[model samples]
Target: MTAVRPWDAFTSAEAEVRAMVADPRWQGLSLHDRAHVLAVRILVTPDGDRWLFGAHARWHLHDPADGRWHPAPPPRGTRARQGRHPSAELPLDVIPDGPDFLAEPGSTQAFIGPDVSERLTEQLRVLLRAAGRKSELEYPLTAFGEIFASDVPSTVAAVWGAIMWCAYAPAFDGNERLITVFGEYLRRPLPGDEWVRWLPTPPLVDLVTLVTERARAGRSRAALRLAAVMADTAQILLSDTRFRPRALALLTMVEPVLREPTLDAGLDDDEAVRRAWLERCPARLCRALMGETDREAHFSHAVYDLVEALQFARDPRQAAATFLADLSDSRGALPARLDHRLRLAYEELDRAGLTGTSAGESTEPDGFPVPGRVLTMPAPVTEVAPPDRASAAAVLGAAYATGLAWGGLTGAKVPERGLAGQAALVRRLIHERDDDHF
Candidate 1:
């Protein structure tokens, strides 16, 4: 397959030296007088092609059939005269920093070392570029229950396996989405009783053993995937008192990986949030069902963009919308609907409370922090009306920022808002159309 240079992966050695040196990937490296030698780790996708990632600026594709590497813009090194048959076989071709600007792949200095941070960062960037049209950031922060819905169980299992295997870096909160997704990778659905009939009673033990062995053998990626799977497994076992022994055993097995710094891992994380939400969800639901008053269900599901939550709640109004909502409309809500729910919940979370956590504490039981009212007052209704300053300000805080930023952005670019005098034409048309319709 053709390997394209990822737009984000193109910075010169001099320009990115500081950032690279600080990276865990470049640990214990001395470049002194020599040029940069990128330890390219090729990620072989399902399409029988590979993407070589790690070089500072350049990219490569290796054809497995004959075992050859190909770089874009034919290399012009000492090996250039040798004919580019096998990239690995090619001689170290150091060209000056001119038109054929980038370094050659077969430079004697080039070697293969699997990088953790830089490699994962590039992988995530590539996924964003390929899978999404926009969003340097992506998805619901942590939905431990969702990966079971994926159709590709084996693939999911394998990917999670790799992540759990390789995820040993200290608490890295740089990419919330990536870390969250890594945890989600473990959300692989557990096989039913029938699927597990052949195994020991508590299958998690054998699974943990296998994962531990793999991790010891330097299979970090697979280890990561298993870590995710075990996380969900532990979540399911949260209510099983009898299974405590097995559950504790499972936790012990995966504790090493969990110790690695990850926002989605550790005691206060998505699982905590999930468990807390689950514990209170039923009570919140009952409250919503009981509401016969003019008041909305303060603790309902409307606040969370349940669908977006399934994906990282990236919609901005995430401030106001993510907290308390109509538990009844738990799936999702529009900005307006979410706003309404927040107002409703705000009134009831405490007769005198702000955003209702049963005890009026900031974080709920499961480690999910309930957001206080970002908008102290309700947003004014706008129906061809003047913009409400409080409503707009609330938007910056609790509501969507882009929803309002668009006015200036669009105006500077194409000025879609028409002339003020056009109102006369609009009024005339309304009058004319009213008579025509009647």
Candidate 2:
């Protein structure tokens, strides 16, 4: 197969970066820096529609045998010579300061302006629609469940999660029909149980051994990243009240050291920690179901028990509970309604009795739910929707700020700082207090 050209990769990367920067959550982030750019690449999809534009801080590595440092090959097949190939059409050296000019790939600097954004958005809209349609036709429920159960590399799982989230999230509009179709795909069953039989068991011990070995060898970055991903995945599972007991058990067994605060203290790198945590998750789950005769039956029971608790509880429950309940009953209220199938699956889990622990055993507490009447609750007062685009933008801006803060992205940073400040400025710029229409 012919390698994809550097020019094409450059264009693709640029588009991905632009889309991320355009997002409200990323408005404050510095896209020009290499680290930020690399982070964005990890976050964004690299298919034709998505691209990232930013500089990579390249370093030359010296060979001990040779006195000189050699530059790595230009990402395989990419020729350094300018103007040599027909595909090398991008102006690789032009840097434009304003919104008027588009970025040239291989340039020292460039900004993707409005034209590129418009073009890429149109292209992505088409591609995303096509993907949503294809996913509806191809991906089966069993495949998704297998993904949950399989011992696939944590990186692959993270990519899958990000892809599904981006494809289904409400932040990007104009694809309601596609979202609906994809939702159907998630609900159907896969080809067979044979696929599941091949699932790899949790590699918790192996991961622990790897981390220990790597740390001994002084490759801390790899270990940290893996550990962070594991921790993050564990936190995600732990937050789900339905999965709390099993998650807790799995976490304890995988990283017995985590039970002590100091040993797990440096698990702050989100991705690595999540991976480390997930390495043990399957085994923990299996152990939890040790006495159960039917695995599916066990899962179903755990879900229903949790849902029942949520539905009948007098006080606020965990965020996961509220999220799950909203998923099962008020589909329209969810930001990603495509997740409804997963929610229903969990609800079925509750009915299956898998949630019941050994007699009289108490599970650890999870998070508290957001307080509010459910979306289906009857409105006691007249509902007054925001009147103008400015107001709408302000609301969204505030929500984004709040979400960032809640998710721990903003540390030691005040709400009045950074992009939140910019958003405030934009609100003032478009202020229309007198007339409701923006």
Q: Note the Cα lDDT for every prediction shown.
A: 0.27, 0.29
Best by lDDT: 2
Model 2 lDDT tens row, 224-320: 4434444444444443232344445444534544344235336544345435444443431432332122333222323322322232223212212
The clash count for each model shown is 35, 45
Q: Give the residue spans of candidate 1 off by over 4 A.
A: 1-121, 125-225, 228-438
Each candidate structure's TM-score, on Cα atoms with residue i matched to residue i, is 0.18, 0.20
Best by TM-score: 2
For each of the candidates, the C-alpha root-mean-square deviation to the true structure, in angstroms, is 26.1, 25.2
lDDT (10s digit) by residue, model 1, range 338-414: 33323343344324432212111111113221232122221121111112322221221111111112211222111
